[model samples]
Target: MTDTHSDDVRPVQPLQPEQLGTYFALMEAVSLLQHQVEQQLRAEGDISYVQFQLLARLAHGPGPLTMTDLADGVVYSRSGLTYQAGLLEKAGLITRGPAPDDDRATLVTLTGAGRALVARVLPGHVEVSRRLLFDPLTDDDVRHLGDIMTRVRDHMRARPPRSAAPRKRQRS
Candidate 1:
């Protein structure tokens, strides 16, 4: 006979010591680097890092993307996306329109001005990124890091998020 407690919920096990160390080191490095990037974006581009990411995403997309599609590509909530889109629209950087194919969906497009803003921000942005992310690593380290990151990202994304967890405001 099976033990009565077997079916009871079992807490997830903690990561092994080495795994914990690696996990935290990665998080710390990413957090520190992101902080520097945010400062650079604010000082040079006069935009928040998230705003820069938003503009870059719209600019790179084949065309206007539906809000749902855009949200899937970046880390943001549906309501939060609407607010950010409104800010860009107010700044004349992007335009939001009802999706032609899907009346229920909204589409976002990057304007010429938006394109220009992204272009202007790229030089400084790339410099800062290289300084923090790429400059310290050797060629082999770059390749290895790319592979590791790609694998990790793919593995994590393969699992759908649980209940679309809400996060606190990520930006001002």
Candidate 2:
């Protein structure tokens, strides 16, 4: 306790070059893996991964979904989803129609061609998914990783807003 003032302070250490290199290497690995997967899908099915994802979502959705709903389901921003949907529509894989309840909103539906394409690709997709993610992990590891990811997603969703909630005055 004699001279604690200066002694208590610690110098900040900068990240080492190796640590930075590792981060870059990890990012490169993920990018390369995604590219490989995309190549495989394109070669086998003649469909891009994003297109496949849209088809899959449309196939699984309850009937026709609005453009906004499709965007939400695919986790794409509205504009991006719209662009992709337009591409799919041009490809004759999906169709767009006016929403039943809202004339302004458009509903997206999977065409027969889209359903057939998904059917053709699903087996390969499942195999790839299994090989990439599940085959290497033990059941407990997979369960734990899924749980952790879900927690992270939920935490992100539950972050408090900067603005305060509105309150109503009580009468005595």
Instruction: Provide the TM-score for each candidate, comma-separated.
Output: 0.86, 0.71
Candidate 2 is scored at a TM of: 0.71
Model 1 RMSD in Å is 6.4
Lowest summed lDDT across 10 adjacent residues in model 2 is found at: 159-168
Alpha carbon lDDT at 91, candidate 1? 94
lDDT of 2: 0.78
Best lDDT goes to which candidate? 1
Candidate models: Cα lDDT each: 0.83, 0.78
Question: Once model 2 is optimally superposed onto the true structure by TM-score, how far is the C-alpha of residue 146 displaced, in angstroms?
Answer: 1.2
- Tens-digit lDDT track of model 1 for 10-128: 55566888888898889999998889988988887778877887899988878788877777677677787788888989999999998888898888999999999999888988998
Q: Where does candidate 2 clash, by residue pair?
A: none
List candidate 2 stretches off by more than 4 Å: 1-33, 157-172
